[model samples]
Target: MTARTLVMLAVLAIAAGTGWLSRGWFEDAQRLTALEAAQAAASQALARESVIAGVVEARLATLDTHQRVIDRGVIREIQKPIYRRVCLEPDAVRLLNDAAAGRAPDPADAADPLPDDAAAVE
Candidate 1:
């Protein structure tokens, strides 16, 4: 072979070796890009879930505040002078107890008259 052909072959061999060695570097760059994308997606998902949790916590806090207000109102109403002075008959007391216990009270019990002493106290 002529010197010119030998030099050309040498150049081709060097180029092929460089390309083969650089293939790993290219593959590593692609893998790094894919990992970065996956990490970004996971971060977005975590942020969305955190927002949902915050909303749920706020709703629960609102419900608790509303419940406290209702409880206070009920306490104030029960402490009124009229309610304090009132006395319930045995049948009426029984009906109230049954109602409070989530049972259906007898209609007949509701129609019973208050005692004479209970009426005088009112």
Candidate 2:
């Protein structure tokens, strides 16, 4: 071929390769923009969840304080010592007398005076 024809062919080939390579660059930029959008959405969702959790925790604390005040008021009203007494009606006593003459009381009727943790140990 002639020198002019060879130079034109070389220029055309370089231009085609550059266009092919820049196509990938454009695709990569589009992918990056989509990823950034997703990350921003996730960050906003996390922030909203955190705010809701904080509000819920604050409300729970207020409820805890209110319950404590009511419990303290009730406990303060009880001044008598703990005691247990069992009295049966006439019909109930007759039934009990017929059932047994002498027998130990049922263990299930015993009052549990221990704290919850101490009872669990037994």
Candidate 3:
């Protein structure tokens, strides 16, 4: 064979080998790009979830404080007036006096209301 023909054959062989190896490299590069894109998407989704969780936590804290204020303020306001009225009733006052004197409550007094007591209840 001529020297030029042998050199041409050698160049063609090297070119074929390079092309075969480079095909796998090109596919790997494409796969790496796809993985990077997927990672970015996942990071964005996590950020959104974190923001939502922060909002929920803040709202829960606000609701908890409001509920505590209602329990302390509104319930106390209602109970104070009701307790005052209860304390002023004749039976309650008598019972409180007897208890202060360390007397046992009269069973008959609790069981049978006087006519005036029944009328006052209405």
Candidate 4:
């Protein structure tokens, strides 16, 4: 073979070998880019979910505080002494019925006289 022809073949052979060796590097770079994009997407989704979880936690804390307040009020009411009426006065019964029906009790009901025994209980 001529010297020029052999040198041309050597250059071509080196070029081909370099291209073959670099193929794997190019493929690895593409895979790394795709993985980075996927990781970024997952990070954004996690941030949004964390925000939602914090809101839910705050709402639950508020609800728990309200329930505690209601429980304290209930305990206070239950601890108060309860007075039992030995007899239900007619006007008092009417007033209770009116209150239960969401109506204002008559002013006259307050002026009505109680039985003699009612004062003894007090």
Candidate 5:
């Protein structure tokens, strides 16, 4: 081979080696981003679940107090408000509305007044 061919081959070999070594770096970066996203989702879910559980516990406690304690008509009995403050963002509201909205009640779902269209067509 000529000197030029040898130099070109050497350059190609070096580039291939560099690419092979760098491949792991790209894969590791991808894995790291995915892991971080998963962790964030997990943390958010945990916090949301904990808050819901606490609300349930508080409601239960309120009910229990109401049943167990016979309050004398003394105006001294302070009643704590046990209201659930649900603040949904626009996106959250849209999601909830979408989920709650069922498919429009099709006429077929009700008692069929007439022979089925499919049957008539057949």
Candidate 6:
């Protein structure tokens, strides 16, 4: 063969070999890029879920504090009027005198209702 022809044939052979060897590498690179994109999407979704959870926790804490305030207000309102009624009753003076003398107050003069469990223990 002529020198020129031999060199040309050698070049073509090398080019074909390189292309064959690199075909799998190019396919693997495409798959790796797709995997990276999927991972990034999953990370963003997890971050959004955490933010939603934090907001719900904060709202629940606020509700708990408001409930405590309402409970305290109701207890105060119920107790205040009962104290005022006891103070203004016409028998208040006599009741104080009997208590100071250590005599047992009559059941009819009791300010509060009797317990349902009072007879249960006997």
Best by TM-score: 2
Residues 1-122, model 4: lDDT tens digits? 99999999999999999998899899999999999999999999999999999999989888733333334444444442234553776677788899899999766657756677977955
Candidate 2 lDDT, 1-122, residue by residue in tens: 99999999999999999999999999999999999999999999999999999999989888743333334444455444332213554445554765697765554544543466875754
Query: For every candidate structure, what is the RMSD over all alpha carbons to the true structure, in angstroms?
Result: 21.1, 20.1, 21.5, 23.6, 20.6, 22.7
Candidate 5 local Cα displacement, residue 13, angstroms:
1.1
Measured with C-alpha atoms, the lDDT of residue 111 in candidate 1 is 67
Residue 44 lDDT (model 3): 100
lDDT of 6 at 11: 100
- Pairs of residues at least 3 apart in sequence or in different chains that clash in candidate 5: none
Write the number of the candidate with greater TM-score, choosing between 5 and 6.
5
Q: Model 3 over residues 1-122: C-alpha lDDT tens digits?
A: 99999999999999999998999899999999999999999999999999999999999888734333335545434457566765477777788899999999986887446666665754
Cα error of candidate 3 at position 68, Å: 14
Location of the lowest summed lDDT over 10 successive residues in candidate 3: 64-73
Q: Model 5 scores what on Cα lDDT?
A: 0.75
Alpha carbon lDDT of residue 21, candidate 6? 81
Error of 4 at 61 (Å): 1.2
For candidate 5, what is the TM-score? Answer: 0.47
lDDT per residue for candidate 5 within 2-89, as digits (tens), equals: 9999999999999999998899899999999999999999999999999999999989888733346667785565555433224544
Best by lDDT: 3
CA deviation > 4 Å runs, candidate 1: 1-6, 65-122
State TM-scores per candidate: 0.44, 0.49, 0.47, 0.47, 0.47, 0.41
The candidate with the higher lDDT, 2 or 5, is 2
